[model samples]
Target: MAYKSRIVQIFIFIITNFFLLLIIDSASSQNILTIESRSDPATPEDCSNRWIHIRNLPSRFNLDLLTNCSDYPLFDDFCPYLANHGLGQKTHIRSRSWYRTDPLLLELIFHRRILEYPCLTDDPDVANAVFLPYYAAIDSLRYLYGPDVNSSFQHGMDLFQFLRSDEPGIWERNMGHDHFLVMARPAWDFSQPLNNDPPVWGTSFLELPEFYNITALVPEGRPWPLQEHAVPYPTSFHPQNLTYFEAWIQRVKRSRRTSLMLFAGGGGIGSAPNIRRSIRNECENGTIKNNISSSSSFNIVQRNGVYSKLCHIVDCSNGICEHDPIRYMKPMLQATFCLQPPGDTPTRRSTFDAITAGCIPVFFEELSAKTQYGWHLPADKFAEFSVFIPKEEVVFKGLRILDVLMGIPRSEVRRMRQSIVELIPRVMYRRHGSSLELRSKKDAFDIAIDGALQTIKDKLGDTLEH
Candidate 1:
């Protein structure tokens, strides 16, 4: 009789547990947010017609602006994102210390399922799969006013919150307004150990997009095609600010007592010795004149009766970029042309510094030409605003780089200086000085800034008082 009782009890327990398991599974399945791709055309006329409010874009906060170039190998037009994976379902978008947004919205690009939630995902295809190109306006004023609002990114808890949900194995494929496949991930954020060594949080994401000027984007680059994938690269054009433009204008107002001043920094890694030699040699030559160069190594060359390296740094933590934020302001305040070259790529901060300091920049890099529509900068409209050394010419024993600087006539040089000067207030020059004079390359950068600014002015353009 006892044995019979034991068997009956086992049967009852098994039945009860089976029913409970079914209930739990059903409850867990309720209302899960699923993300999937939307059927939208690549180019829509209305895309650029409006301004968007970005809470924070991964691209804005992750990539290093000084080192980033549009033509760099990583800048897309070559990444299919999810197609290379052997299994179509295992699409993992890659992000590094440079790109943070790519992993936030991976599911939306696949179109395999629907996003049932209002957030982002860690999957690359799901994160960057679907995003809107928004005219960016960062909240710099808020940060500036707060002074202590160092918000914690908490090891990208914010990103993981949006990209990777809390529960494991519970991913949804859906697109949200914050979906964007950023090219890189920033290692740093406001949260830090406070005693941790370099690589410091947010090196790649140093400047937040919420703190900068961004305008106009379109859908052009997608991660996947319409039928199979949804990850699209951003096709919306963004206009750049003309940092060199204002420098040119500022030069027109300066006195004649100034000599040339050039300060070059960005040491250790990006700072190459030969490139530094090239810059110093040009400045020191009598034929290639420069007033000053802030040197980090060796001495600033003395050419054409001008000084170089009024400032120098062997190694500095914060001091590397501090001294004269404006590359040529102190020297060019009295001089004419600033000896500027492309830093690794033609898109470094030097381009903005020289132009904004009222000094003309001489482009000596092959990449400089690429910045001008990936064609010859001499033939481009920007050619009217800056100077370039023709790549095909040779003036030295064989053909030295310095010879190119000497070969240009004074008349043509003067014209470009003046044109750049006139464009300053309209482009790079800002009354505050914090928001102007940047990569004087991209027409999109220039156009977007102007268009967005004009939009604001249009609101004020009304001859009325609120």
Candidate 2:
């Protein structure tokens, strides 16, 4: 009886020890999971792999420029654009998606969005890229319109000197190859030559050797690719959330496009004079040879029908389109094709606006859209959404813009319009403080940042291999 009791006690002791081990193991696993959950919460989907470190630039570079916004240009009021963190004044539109946005305020918009970026790291050691929050466009504005040509390069020179002296470690790390800045102005605005005989119109900021490796995000990039990249110019529509964005997309998709083509800009504005002038002359005269068919080749009438007006002109010659969204947006929403000729630069902000309204953009220059916005509009799919008519063909050959548009089949037009509708989200700049609930969707700013990071990554990788 004593031996039997001893065996039973031993078995009980063994069972209790085994159960305790299992319990301890389970508790350890729970603790580990808790630590992991606290350490690695969900980040924005687009920022999962990339982290950016925004350099702490001096106030003179950005804030001071905004404080003196009214003093820069005598004719234009920039204070309105400086409002809403560079989103410009909000319009009275019911949806609250549209603003009287100025295209030159992209630096403000980009800076605001990046502040809310999810993967921003305080540690520069771990950052995938660095952003210099210098408002290059605003800085240039001070000297661009001033009389002293030699002082044009002063601000940029001071900026680089400050970067080298104060943030030497960051500047020396890859020699600014991973650093990027946003310039709302065109690339030419900063590329003025110092040795020009009569002193050119722009500043010498881009010509500085310090700017060689830095990537410049501009509205219009140079024709021969360097470090300059073209980003979408800000349009009036800045949706606050995914729901509003989708609603606008649906509205544009369902719009009844009554007019065949639309031109909503002023003529006699840019270096390329003939293109816009020709368009204006053609639109005003309202006469084109009926070249749609061989039977009616000689008849001077609108091609589509006998008495119907095929082209719609908003006539922004009075300069009302710049501040008023209703003037241009309405015509674009009602037209099948929006004409995008070269504006003050090779590109125009109206191109993106037309896309927002789900109107197919008709380009007159290769640099206007094809070469400029490759980051937002894919090169392989350019034909899927836009139409291209060479400026030479239109200026020299007397090509009928209406006949070319009328030749496209109705089915093809519908397909192209649908493609443009799908691209609305990509070309738009989402409101600065909007929620990231729709993590799957990335906007124009998101695309630009991602592209910058990826390009830096590739360049760094190549350096390592070589």
Pairs clashing within candidate 2: none
Which regions of candidate 2 deviate over 4 angstroms?
1-49, 93-95, 268-273, 287-308
lDDT of each: 0.32, 0.77
Which numbered prediction scores highest in TM-score against the true structure?
2
In TM-score terms, candidate 2 sits at 0.85
Give the best candidate by lDDT: 2
Q: After superposition, how far is residue 149 of candidate 2 from its true place, in Å?
A: 4.0
Give residue 454's lDDT in candidate 1 (0 to 100).
Answer: 47
Give one digit per residue, the lDDT tens place, for model 1 in 1-466: 9778656545543453354234323323422222122222223333232322222233333221111211233223112222211011111243110011122112212111111112323332323223322111111111212232254223233443543454312223322322322221111222134334542322211233321121112111112211111111211111123443333344456545234334354433434444444444444542432434434222433443433432222222343332223333445455455544444334333444455444565565544433332211223566676656543342222334444533556677667667755543332311111222333233322243333334333433342354
